[model samples]
Target: MRVSSLLRFRSTSLQTSIAKQQQYVPQHKPAVQDDIKRLEDFLISKPNILVLSGAGISTESGIPDYRSEGVGLYARTNHKPIQHLEFVKSSSVRKRYWARNFVGWPNFSSTQPNATHHALARFEREMRVQAVVTQNVDRLHTKAGSRNIVELHGSGYVVKCLSCEYRIDRHEFQTILATLNPAFKDAPDMIRPDGDVEIPVDYIENFHIPECPECGGNLKPEIVFFGDCVPRPRLDKIAEMVYNSDGLLVLGSSLLVFSGYRMVLQMKDLKLPVAIVNIGDTRADHLADIKISAKCGDVIPKLFDFRKTNPL
Candidate 1:
């Protein structure tokens, strides 16, 4: 009769259509129905819900994620990273890494947060999501309007002088890097999604790894390098929120990294239920109470409607 009523009618008709399709499915999807109810009930209860997000949440924003075959960020930025220690010890490694990052900054910073990011932002606004703990350095979760976010890894938008510890904005550092590595100017190199590049070996060997203009310390991107540990304060912040929250929601993480995997273990210790909406078997698959093998784009939007107690 009216727009609102018409929309509701269409919703009912769609449910009927889905129910009919369910009847044709070979296996009964009782679990699917149950999961939807659990999700809705949990949200309706308004328990503090903590988010543990990975790259998958940002994939829809045109930002590449890791592990989704054609959609993964790593597959695009397949260049192997030189370890922080190695870079520090070998001038060659530092020069090469920084040179590549300098060229890649524009593309990386230009990426905007996507639907899944916006959905999480909405959840926070709706008071359904209390906090976010993420492994991504892109800072998308915060960009999405998540107020309380603990970044287990460092942010890509920052670079610090190894000696001075002065954090400079990534763009400012890129200009400094460009001035120092002039050999890479107009040089042909392959660019990748994660803001990394493939370049000639000699270019790095001769390039100077500059000192901090303010403090005379060696310069480095602030991101948590492979083999580096996340600071204790960051870990404590996540633990505090998780302990207080009613449930945990993991999005798009494979959990190959220990920082994220540890959160699953923490939930186990707290006896709090963990629900995962990832595309693959993460290290926490056995730990999660509800595992949705779907993309974040699909799962997060539907979470607005799904619940735990649907009357048969």
Candidate 2:
């Protein structure tokens, strides 16, 4: 999904608005309980499990998944890749991007990790989950307490100089952006889940773009933008974990992106035990060993609850 499609955000306010707009679908209904039960038992036997996650895990926290029905996070603009070239080549475009973020930040930043995130955290406490390979940039898993995690896409919490690679805290970058584009502080009106802000091109043109503090160069959000590739190191880390694992539990992810889908294929070819919990059709459904088609919010909490309360 395009960054813009995710949501217009630089902070949690963006999260509040998205939560208000999107409805939480009840998950883990009867259609998927058997699979959930089987998955719960399997974890008890294996103990050492590796978890792979995507946006679905974060949806319960109020962020919208890219492919879900209804007006998606990036519905109006359509999901289009925001490239490095556009940001560096056109000041107007970059300004608009920042403006969109300024208004959308609060709603996006306000989100908390949900039950699935906490379940993983609790499971990790049992010393069973080996690693967390996630496609989400939301950092909910980390907030939930999973330490051994690999973000296949870079995080949104930082920013870098596009020209110099000097990093800055996203908070610092936000200050600079707000200072330079004072007019845009209140300009944004639309929010998306991936945290992209929707603002007008005219507003962008009128805004003053900020320069990097270190080199007086262009700065971009420290995230893996669409059309940009994940570096080799991140992919290698995921592959290493997945290949080394006895089982792979894909929770709350549709596995649509090639970065993730390729990993799934890698696991399948290696014949690793693969299971999934997601609400919609996914590229890996046919490939999964145990497919539990349900909402993760309903499923994960219940799965853990069952593991604790019942003998199964």
Candidate 1 wrongly placed segments (more than 4 Å): 1-38, 69-78, 183-189, 192-196, 305-312
lDDT (Cα, tens digit) per residue for candidate 2, span 1-312: 567755555346766755653454433455466767888887777677788898877777767666666534555346555676676688776866666666666676667788789888888887768888888878888899989988888777777888796888777666776777666655444554445566666676776656777789987877787678899888887888877788888887778788888878888888777888887778899988888888776677766674578776
**Candidate 1: tens digits of C-alpha lDDT, residues 156-199:** 98888877657888887777767877776764355632334676
Q: Candidate 2, TM-score vs. the true structure?
A: 0.83
Count of backbone collisions in candidate 2: 30
Best by TM-score: 2
Error of 1 at 253 (Å): 0.4
Measured over all alpha carbons after superposition, the RMSD of each candidate to the real structure, in angstroms, is 9.1, 7.9
Candidate No. with top lDDT: 2
